[model samples]
Target chain A: DVKVTQSSRYLVKRTGEKVFLECVQDMDHENMFWYRQDPGLGLRLIYFSYDVKMKEKGDIPEGYSVSREKKERFSLILESASTNQTSMYLCASSSTPVTNYGYTFGSGTRLTVV
Target chain B: EDQVTQSPEALRLQEGESSSLNCSYTVSGLRGLFWYRQDPGKGPEFLFTLYSAGEEKEKERLKATLTKKESFLHITAPKPEDSATYLCAVHSFSGGYNKLIFGAGTRLAVHP
Candidate 1:
């Protein structure tokens, strides 16, 4: 089975602190994405990388940034965490073209900004 | 604009009772529609993908059918283990490289 592994399951950070969430996929997928899931709005994309060192801002990328240094690892960074940034962060990777394959998501990281 | 909507924010059923969930979408050019089951505190698990209207797929006790305007996930004789939030998302040719548009999702609870 394909696996997307997230570094942390839960984290608490002080407001304005720098934070990092990591994701690594074992399937050698080419596309990786970062999304934040909230109660009413569902999952909204933050950033995505289609290849190493390549990134695109998703619908909601205001407070987040991403790094794809290697094919297997994608990381999401919060420049300065805020209370509004507290939410469940999800990482996903897809190997096939967007039209043909759905994403394989990690277990998720629940981040709380105080 | 590309958008997706799911009806019945929540549903509760007794064991052996069956029900259906709905997902509605509107996009410029539909590429695919996907169904996923998410357990609490866990990432979503892929269930099925429906590419075109009239397409259907099934697994265990779950069946997903898609139409041009919407899709339905029918749960047959559901069990307690089937309780989870069902999400629907759409991938379309809007910006050419746009990400999938997701709905709010239907939270289903099955009682034994």
Candidate 2:
């Protein structure tokens, strides 16, 4: 079975603090994504990396950045955490576009900014 | 722009009741439509994927069907364990990089 693991399941950070959320997938997938889930807005993509050292901005990428030094690991960085940034973060991985399967998502990390 | 919208923000049903959730979308070219079940505080679990109109896929008591502009997920004789948030997403062929546009999702609650 494919497994996507997040570094932390719950996190609390103070305002103006820098935060890092890590995600690792064991499926050797080529595509990785980061998304934030809010109460009524659902999941909005923050960023995605298709290969090592390659990244693309999604719909809501402000205040967020991502790093992909290896194909199996993706990290989401919050330059300066704020109360408004508190939400559930999810990481996912997929094989490829041509013969794509659904994404395998991590359990998710709930971040609380104070 | 590719967009997806799910209807009936929330639904309440009794055990053994059957109903359908709707997902409407508009995109340049529809590559795929996907359904997922998300439990509270957890990531979504893949349910089914529909590639074209008239295509149907089923697993246990859930059936998903697609049309030219929308998809329907029908739940048959649902049980309490089936309660969860149902999400729909659309992959646009011209969107570049196979990015999926998702809907807000429909929350379903089943009573025993």
- What tens digits encode model 1's per-residue C-alpha lDDT throughout B1-112? 8899998999999999999999999988888899999999999988999989999999999999999999999999999999999999998655447588889899999999
Each prediction's DockQ against the real complex: 0.72, 0.63
Residue B103: error of model 2 in Å?
A: 0.6
What's candidate 2's DockQ score? 0.63
As a whole number from 0 to 100, the lDDT of residue B90 in candidate 2 is 86
Can you give the TM-score per candidate against the true fold?
0.97, 0.96
- Write down the lDDT of every candidate, Cα atoms only: 0.92, 0.91
Model 1 spans > 4 angstroms off: none
Best by TM-score: 1
Each candidate: RMSD to true structure?
A: 1.0, 1.2
